[model samples]
Target: MCPRCRGEALLWARVPYGWTNREGGRVEGRSGVVLCPACDARAPGAAALITWFHVHGRADDEDEEFVRLLVRWATGVSVPPLDEHAPEAENERWQRGDL
Candidate 1:
């Protein structure tokens, strides 16, 4: 059972991090974190990242898209811009008086 959410199917992962400083100094480390897929609760180390992907990876919930949106908010991943184009098929039908 997960301490946070009391969920049974908790997922644990060791996330790795690596970075290089301006002087070419390399730093790397890993952190162990637990996630509750049932209730979207994450352990301490998991908070440093957007753990939605791990928590919701196995979910078949109908609200998955909403979850995705929330993940984008948490991760600062921007939503793709919508294409700006007229409905050409509908316009053509209207011009032909088919509507």
Candidate 2:
């Protein structure tokens, strides 16, 4: 679920950014991307994290935790933590439409 819109089908992407020379030479860097299919909201690049923190963070400590969770989710290394106050089973509940 997306933190901003509570959308169920949150999408992750790696968009590219950076400089391109006059001759069309390019230097690209990857951006973190999260898209809310339900709302058509887009969170892209480092700005994504900033937006997430601004919209979802409850305390200073939550900032790092959110980032870590997002990274894990985006990398497919692990599932992202749901609401900090909710138990891990909340994700299961969400999938079961019990949340």
Best by lDDT: 2
As a whole number from 0 to 100, the lDDT of residue 26 in candidate 2 is: 71
Write candidate 1's Cα lDDT for 1-99 as tens digits.
Answer: 656567674445454555666688976756544454554434333343335455555533367664554443334322233233457877888999998
Best by TM-score: 1
Clashes of 2: 0
Which ten-residue region of model 2 has the weakest summed lDDT? 76-85
Error of 1 at 34 (Å): 1.3
Q: Estimate each model's TM-score.
A: 0.27, 0.26
TM-score of 1: 0.27
| Worst ten in a row by lDDT for model 1 | 75-84
Reference-based lDDT, each prediction: 0.49, 0.52
lDDT of 2 by residue, 1-99 (tens): 656577664445574455666687875667655545444333323345445645774324356766664564455322232243577677789999997
Candidate 1: where are CA atoms >4 Å away? 1-9, 19-24, 38-99
